[model samples]
Target: MQPTHRSRRILRPVRIWFVYLSLCVALLLSYVPTGQVPGVPDWVALLLAFWCVRERQHVGMGAGFIFGVLVDIGYGAAMGQHALAYVLLAYAANAVSRRVLWFTPLQQSIQILPLLLGAQLVMVVVRMLAGAEFPGWGYFLSSVTGTLLWLPLHFVLLLPQYQPEERDNNRPI
Candidate 1:
């Protein structure tokens, strides 16, 4: 059976709030220091990428750009460095998300690696362009860690979507 108009209306606001809360959490994580971690912890990037997968329309290029700027401000990095990287990375991820078969955990895991790496590469280039010297090859390690973290993260946020799917399946013809 088709969803009633009232159900659709109720879901709209709920979906909006979900996206908003995810963005807020992403921003907050970006600011938290990693302490002894050799570089930025993978959680922030992984969370951002996970949000992009789940809420592509809501967390597209513009949102990614804004988050990047916020990170730069919070981290006191060169202006626009993270912004440019994030926007480009979001665009790439958005494009890939549309075509990729997302049914399997392996597929999703495979898809996330390139998106995370591309974003990190963009930041590396931007830093170099801005005359910031290379920290080391170790900087890219965050992308690896981020990609590994994506699996558990994706499943957690995806629980709501699964409930809706199961409910639809249980409905009578």
Candidate 2:
């Protein structure tokens, strides 16, 4: 006898408040002193990318621009540097969200790596244009770290939306 596979259940829609709260947390994380350390992922960028992919309709360039501006203020970076990077990130994430949702988190991370890298590249270019010296290649380590973290972040973010697994014999779902 062949084993039959069960279809995956649809996840509950993500709440808008929860998404904004998570982004706020990400902002706080980025504000931590350790953020200057090599390989410390850009928490705001990572979280923003995740939401852009999962809830493009609800969270996109607006959230990106707002949080990006906040980040710029927090870092005292050139105004709109992070904002531009994040807006582009949101757009790219939304553009590919459908295809990304079709993959496992591991595979999704691989796809997201380039998007993260591109955002970082945009920041670097902005800094250079503002007459800042190159921060060096180590700066990109954040994207790598963020990519490595994608799997766990994926599970954590989705946890609240998962429905209970108990079978309800009384109801047809």
**TM-score for model 1?**
0.78
The window of 10 residues in a row where model 1 has the poorest summed lDDT is 5-14
- List, in order, the clash count of every candidate structure: 0, 0
Residue lDDT tens for model 2, 1-173: 53344236567878889999999999998988884578999999999999999999999999999999999999999999999999999999999999998888889999999999999999999999999999989999999999999999998999888765665888554
lDDT of 1: 0.70
Q: Over the full model, what C-alpha lDDT does candidate 2 score relative to the true structure? A: 0.92
lDDT of model 2 at position 163: 63
lDDT of each: 0.70, 0.92
lDDT of 1 at 85: 77
Name the weakest run of 10 consecutive residues (lDDT summed) in model 2: 1-10
Residue 143, model 2, lDDT: 100
